[model samples]
Target: MPRLPIIHKTQLVASSRLFQVEEVHLEFSNGEQRIFERLVSRGYGAVLIVPMLDNETVLLIREYSAGTERYELGLPKGKVEPGEDLFEAANREIMEEVGHGAHHIQLLKRVSLAPGYMGHHTNLLLARDLYPATQPGDEPEPLEVVPWKLNRLDELIAGNECTEGRSLLALYMVRDLFMRLNR
Candidate 1:
């Protein structure tokens, strides 16, 4: 692997309730220098849960997204709170968003959103053996839980409401995983 660029300086460029932007000054080994801005991640990180309703169905949620200003259909996801392990956070988010808790949970992978400009990594988890459960979430309104068949992922991705890249990638990963396991 190549050596990483040296960060000469960093400054907080902006801040908000849920996000912080930082400007980084870097010097490369080849005598190149540049400044870049990134959204500084806060807290332990986050968990995106691909909750399986069955071997064929995955649970998704339709909730309002302030960033897109529309209702997005995606997997249940939330930050991993202080002291909460990834599995605990995954289960909690599923309970809060999809009204179910998983008896079997496995960490699939860790993914970054815009790794070039965002210092955030989300744990992608696969949750199975679901049971009915609900916990009040911090959402302003109730989330609509949608169970989607894994076999029809292409149709779901074709829809406009399911545009989040992270969610789409997680679904594909889960589908591939199940296929390999069944084989």
Candidate 2:
């Protein structure tokens, strides 16, 4: 196995209200040194929730995605407020976006979109036993809550505008989890 590279230095090159780009200098074990640029989040990590509306149904949200320049369908997600619990953040986001809160929440996994150049981590959560709830959210416009069947995830991907990788992957993971548990 190869040893991890040593970080020589890291410098902030750019900053924005939502992101920070940093330049990282690294030296390999074999005397190879390189400088790489990556993103550094200014806050704690985020949470992506798969809010289950029923045994076979999951609640998704359709919201405008500036990165893709269109509305995308995916699970409710938000940043973890400083010092806030990850599960609490997931429940809060689901309630604010989907008009429901979960009584049971399980951590699915933590994922990185592009670990090669991005430093953001989103903890995936599976939320169940939901009840009607809502709180004011920071979204500029109200989101459309979509109910999707766990067995029809392929249709959700093939026919709908669902495109967030983390949400898609988490949905599949939760579905498989249900399958394994049911068996």
Q: What is the C-alpha lDDT of each candidate?
A: 0.93, 0.92
**How does residue 33 of candidate 1 score in lDDT?**
98
Model 2: per-residue Cα lDDT over 1-183, one tens digit each:
779999999999999887899999999999999999999966889999999998899988899999889999998999999778999899899889999998999999999989999988999999999999999999999999989899999997787589788999999999999999889
Model 1 CA lDDT for position 49: 93
Against the true structure, what is each candidate's TM-score? 0.96, 0.96
lDDT score for candidate 2 against the true structure? 0.92
State each candidate's clash count: 0, 0
| Model 1 alpha-carbon drift over 4 Å, by segment | none
Model 2: residue 19 alpha-carbon error in angstroms? 1.6
lDDT of 1 by residue, 22-55 (tens): 9999998887999999999888999999999988
